[model samples]
Target: MEKLEEQIAHLTRAVDDLSDIVARQEGEIVTLNRRVHMLMQREGEREASSGGAVVLGDEKPPHY
Candidate 1:
């Protein structure tokens, strides 16, 4: 029936729209993951260079 066909067409469009949204999210997730990985690497390097020093006090250093 025509009504059934119309419903099918609407559902198809909705599915396509959702697919596009999912693809965009996948790309964004990949970019965010890469940024997080780079940030972690930089943090690791910083910790290593700093020799993992622990500040005993809540006060800021005099350099601030």
Candidate 2:
């Protein structure tokens, strides 16, 4: 029937749109994951250099 054909066409378009959205989101996730990994690596290096000490602002006198 014509109605059925129209419904099928609409459903097809909707599916295609969703597929595009999913593809774009997947690409963004990959990029973000890479960035996060790089940041974590940098943090690890920094911590290693600092000898794992938690630096709090500038060094102060023990009496202060």
Candidate 3:
């Protein structure tokens, strides 16, 4: 019975630790999603101003 109690205690602690990790991840995901949304908005504005041409800086010129 004592062994079973000890196992239960350990499992409870593990569950609590995992719950904290999940909570932290959820917060981080929210922050990252917000940042992505803002970036997309900015890109959309830039594209509109650039006459719908998507200019990727990595592209080489015709001379290349």
Clashes of each: 0, 0, 0
Tens digit of per-residue lDDT, candidate 3, span 6-56: 999999999999999999999999999999999999989988999977587
Candidates sorted on TM-score, descending? 3, 1, 2
Q: What value does the lDDT take at residue 60 in candidate 2?
A: 82
TM-scores for every predicted model? 0.83, 0.82, 0.84
Residues 1-64 of candidate 1 have per-residue lDDT tens digits of 9999999999999999999999999999999999999999997998789887764565588899
TM-score of 3: 0.84
Once fitted onto the true fold, the runs of candidate 1 whose alpha carbons sit more than 4 angstroms away are 55-64
In order, candidate lDDTs are: 0.92, 0.94, 0.94
lDDT of 1 at 51: 88
lDDT of 3 at 18: 100
Cα deviation at 55, candidate 1, in Å, is 5.7
TM-score of 2: 0.82
